[model samples]
Target: MINILKGMKDRHSDDVKKYDFIMDTAKKIFSKYNFEKIITPILEETELFRRSVGDETDVVSKEMYDFIDKGGRSVTMRPEGTAGVVRAYLEAGFHKADPIVKWYYNGPMYRYEAPQKGRYREFHQVGTEVFGIRNPYLDAEIIKMGCDFLEELGIKDLTVELNSLGNVESRKRYINDLKDFMAQRFDKLSEDSKRRYEKNPLRALDSKDKGDQEQFKDAPKLYDYLDEESREYFEEMKKYLEIMGISYKENPKLVRGLDYYSDTVFEIKSDKLGAQSTVLAGGRYDRLLEIMGKVKIPGIGFAAGMERIAMLMDDSLIKEEKKGVYIIYFNETKEYFIKIADIMRQNNIKINFDYNPKSFNAQIKKANKINVEYVIILGEEEKDENIVTLKNFITGEQKKYSVDEVVNIIK
Candidate 1:
C-alpha cells in the first residue's frame, strides 16, 4: 500500500520550490502591468463550469471532479479560472467600483484525467483576467503580458498560435455551415467527435480524431465566416502584435474548448515539450461578463500553466534564495533555544533548524544537506564564552563572535 501511494506525488521538494518561484515571478510581472490579485474558492457550484466551459467540453463532461456537498448541492473543483473570476466579479460588485478590472490568480485546479507529463488530476495555473474592455489594444496588451512572462522564465522556441473565433454573427453562420458539412461525415467521425457534433460541432474541429483532422483540411475555415467588422478587429490585433515584434501563426482551427470566447483566441506552444504542448492559453471573452450577468462589458485575458512552464525549463534553475544562517545547536541547549531563535527572527535574518533533536554530528550533516550559505555552531565553548562560531559553508572559513557580534555579522 505504501509503495503504491509513494509512486503518486503531491509534488517533490524540488518541484515545489520551482512552483513557488514561478508563482512569485508571475505575480511580479502581473503587478508591473497593474494587474491586481484575486483568488476564488477551489470548489464552486457545478453548473458554473457546465455553463461557461461548455457542456460538450471534456472538462465539463468527463474530467471535472464533482460531487454533492453536505448540503446536497452539487459542487465541483474549478477546472479553469475565467468562470470563477466572472462569478466573483458579479458576486462582489467590482464592476461598479472599477470600470476596468484586471486580476491575477495562482492555484491548483482539479480535473479527473489520466496523469501524464504535464496533465494531472491536480495542477497549478497562473491566470490573469481583464474585464470591461473590448479594444483590440487590450487584447494585444494581454498577449504581450503572457509573452513577457515566458521571456522572464528563460523559455524560448515558443510560437504563439493565434485565432479569432469571430463574433456571434460569424459563429452562427459558421456553425450552420459546419453542421451541414459534418452531417455527411457523421459516420466517419470517431465516437467522441460524433458526440461532440451533437453538442458543439465547432469543437469537432479541435478533435484529435485522425478522420476529423483529414476532413478539416478541406473544410471551410472560420475566417471565411468572419463578418467585415470582426475581420477588421482581428487585422488590427495582428498589426499590434507585429509592431511589438510578437510572431504568431493564424491557426483558424484552434478553437478553444469553451463557449465564452468570442474573438482573438491564442495558445503559446514550445517545441521542447512534445505534441500536447501549450504553456499558455487564453483570449478575448467579449461576452463572459454579459453572460454571467455582471454587465455588458467585454474583455481579454490569458492563463499560463505553471507546471508546463516548469516542465520546459531546467528544474535546477528555480531554487529559493539561501538563508543567511543554518543553526546548529546541541540537544542539551533546549532551554535557550527559543531565545536564540527569537533573536535571529526579530533581526530579519532567515535561519533553518529542524526541531527534532539529533547528535551534533548528525545535525552538521543535516545542515550540509539543506545547503545554506552559513552555519552557526552553539557548542559548549561558544555558549561558555557567550559567543557563537560562524562557519561559511561555501568558503570553509570560520570565525567566533559575541552574541551582539553574531547579530551584526548576520544582519
Candidate 2:
C-alpha cells in the first residue's frame, strides 16, 4: 500500500520545488503585465462547469469528476480554473474593478481521464485571465505572457498558431459551410469525427481519421469566413506579435474545443512533445460572462499546463535544496538532545532527529538516507561542556562548537 501511494504521488518535495519556481516566476511576470493573483477553490458547484465549459465539450461530457456532496448538491473538482475565477469575479463583485482586471491562478485541476506522459488525471496549470476587456492588445498581451513563460523555461523552437472563431453570425455561416464539407466526407471520417459531425462540425478539421484527413485538405478555411472586424482584430494581433519578434503559424483549423471562445483563438506548440503537444492554449471568450449570468463583460486569456512545461524544463536550472540538519544522540542525554533539536527548529533550521531510539549506526544511515547535511553529535563530553560536535557526513569533517555558537551559525 505504501509503495502504491508513493508511485501515485504527484507533488513530491522535488516536484514541489519545480511547481514553486514555475508559479513564483509566472506570478512575477503576470504582475509585471498588470495582472493580480486570484485563487479559487478546488471544488465548486457542478453547474458552474456545465455553463462555463459547455455541456457538450469534453471537459463536461467526459473529463469532469462531478459528484453529489453530503448536502445532496452536485459538486465537481474543477477541471480548469477559469470558470471558478469568473464565478468569483461575479460573486465577489470584482466586476466594478476599473473595467479591466487581469488575474492569474496556479493549482491542481482534476480530470477523469487516462494518464499519459505529461498529461495526468490530476494535473497542474498556470492560468491568466483578463476580464472586462476586448482589446486585441489584451489578447496579444495574454499570448505574449504564455510565450515569455515558455521561453523563460528554456524551451526553444516554439511556434504560436493563431485563429479566429468570429462573431455569432459569421460563426453560424462557417459552421454551416463546415457542416456541408463534413457531410460529403462523413463515410470517410473516424468514428469519433462522425459522432462530432452533428454536434461540433468544426472539430472535424482536427480529425485524425486518414479518410477525413484527405477531405480537410480543401475544407473552407476560417480566414475566408472572418468578418471585417474579426479580420481586423486578427491583423492587429499579428502586428503586435511581429513587433515583439514572436513567430507564429496561422492554423485555420486551430479552433479550441469549447463553446465560449469567439473572435480570437490560439495555441503554442513545442516540437519537444510530438503529436499531443500544446504547451499552452487559450483565446478570447467574449460571450462567456453573458452565458454565465454576468452582463456585457467579454474576456480574453490562456492557460499553460504546468506538468508539460515542467517535463520539458531543464533540470540544471534549479538545484533542489536538501541541506537539512539532523540531531544524532548516543547513549545518554536524551533530554538535552531533544531540547537542542527544539531550539534548532525554533530558529527555522530543518532539524531531523529520529525518535525511534535506535542505535548510532542505524540513525546515521537514516540521516544519510533522508539526505540531511550536518549530523549533530551529542554525547557525554559535548553535553557536559555545553558544546556539540557537528559532522559533515558527506565530507567526514568534524568540528566542535559551543551551543550558542552553533545556534548562531545555524540561524
Candidate 3:
C-alpha cells in the first residue's frame, strides 16, 4: 500500500474536531475586535515571499514548496499567511476600502521541512492583520487579544518575549555592526552562521547552532543601536502593554524570522510544548505594503500555529460530543422511530436513530456508548399507545410521554 507523504499525517474525526474548535474560538474573539475574515489562494508567485519575507530567509531559500507551473511561471505554495494576505489586500483593492482595515484568516500553510511533534510540513495557522494603523497602543491591543484568546483556551503559564528591531535606518546600522562583530570570529562560527553573516546578519542572531549562539554571546545587541525615534516607540509600546496589565520580558536578541518586521516584535511562548514552545508570534511591519505594492501602508499582525495550540490544549476543554437524543427501536418499530426523529429534528432538537436492527439491550448499549443526553425506546406497547419511553441518561429516570410531550421536553 502507498503510504502518506513524510512530514504529513491524516487527521481523524477527533483531531479535526479539535482543530475546528480552535478556529471557531479564534473567529469569535476576532469578531469582537471587528476584524473581518479574509482568505487567499494557497498558490502564489514565488517572488511574493522572496520580496516580503526576505530572499535570503530560510522560508524562501529552503523551506518553500516552489516549482514551475505548466505555464512556465514560477509559483509557490504559501509557507506563511502574511505575505498572501498582503498580496490579496493590494490585488483586490482593499487599500481603497477603510482607513483602518482588520482581517483574520485561518488555513493551511506548506513548507518543506523536518516534521516533529506539533510541527508539520503542511500545518495550519490562524493569523490577524491590521492595516493603516501605527499607534503603539494598537500594537499592545493586538498582543492583549492574542493572550486573551490563549487564556480562553485554558493555556496558562505563557511568557511574552518582546523586542524592538527599530526603523529601517536603525536596523541597517545594527546589521552592519553585527556583521563586523561576527567577522572577527568568522572561523569560530558554524558553516550556516558564516553564510547567514554575509546574507542576513540579523538571522544569525536567531541561529540555533551552538557555536553560533556562543559567538552571539558577546555580539552587540540590537537595542543599543535603536535610533531615538525607535527607542521612544519601543518604550511607548511597553508603556501601553504595562497599562493594559500585560507582563512581558524584553529579549534583546528577539529578531523575528521575517524580513519586514520593524519596531515592536513579540512572541507568546508556553512551556507545555518542548523546544517548539512558541504558540503565537508577530511583529510590526510598517513598510511591507510599500515594498510589495509601492503603496505605503503600516500593518501589524500575529500568526499562531493551529497544530501547536491544539497540541497544548487540554482535551477536557473541548466539548467534543453534542448532547442529543438517541432513538433505539426494534425491527418492527423502525418506521415509527424514524418519524419521531424527524419531528424532533424539525423542532430544532438534535436527534440520532440507530439504523441497524438490534435487540433492546444491544441498542441501549449503543446509545450509552454515544453518551447521548436521552434515549428513546420504540417498543410495541409504546407504538400501540402512540407514546414513547424516554430515559434520561444522566438522571437515570424514565417516563412515558406523548409525541408532542417528548418533542417539548427534548426541545
For TM-score, the strongest prediction is 3
Superposed Cα deviation of residue 92, candidate 1 (Å): 1.4
Candidate 2: lDDT of 310?
Answer: 86
What would the TM-scores of all predictions be? 0.90, 0.90, 0.94
> In terms of TM-score, how similar is model 2 to the real structure?
0.90
Give per-residue CA lDDT, model 1, range 50-115, as digits (tens).
Answer: 877877778888989899999999999898888898898888887888768889998888888788
Which candidate order results from sorting by TM-score in descending order?
A: 3, 1, 2
Per-model CA lDDT versus the true structure: 0.82, 0.83, 0.88
Q: Is candidate 1 or candidate 3 better by TM-score?
A: 3
Local accuracy of candidate 2 as per-residue lDDT tens digits, 245-319:
888889888886666789889999887856648889999988888899757799988888888888877766776
- Residue 32 in model 1: lDDT: 94
C-alpha-based local distance difference test score of model 2: 0.83
Clashing pairs in 1: none
TM-score of candidate 3 versus the correct structure, residues matched by position:
0.94
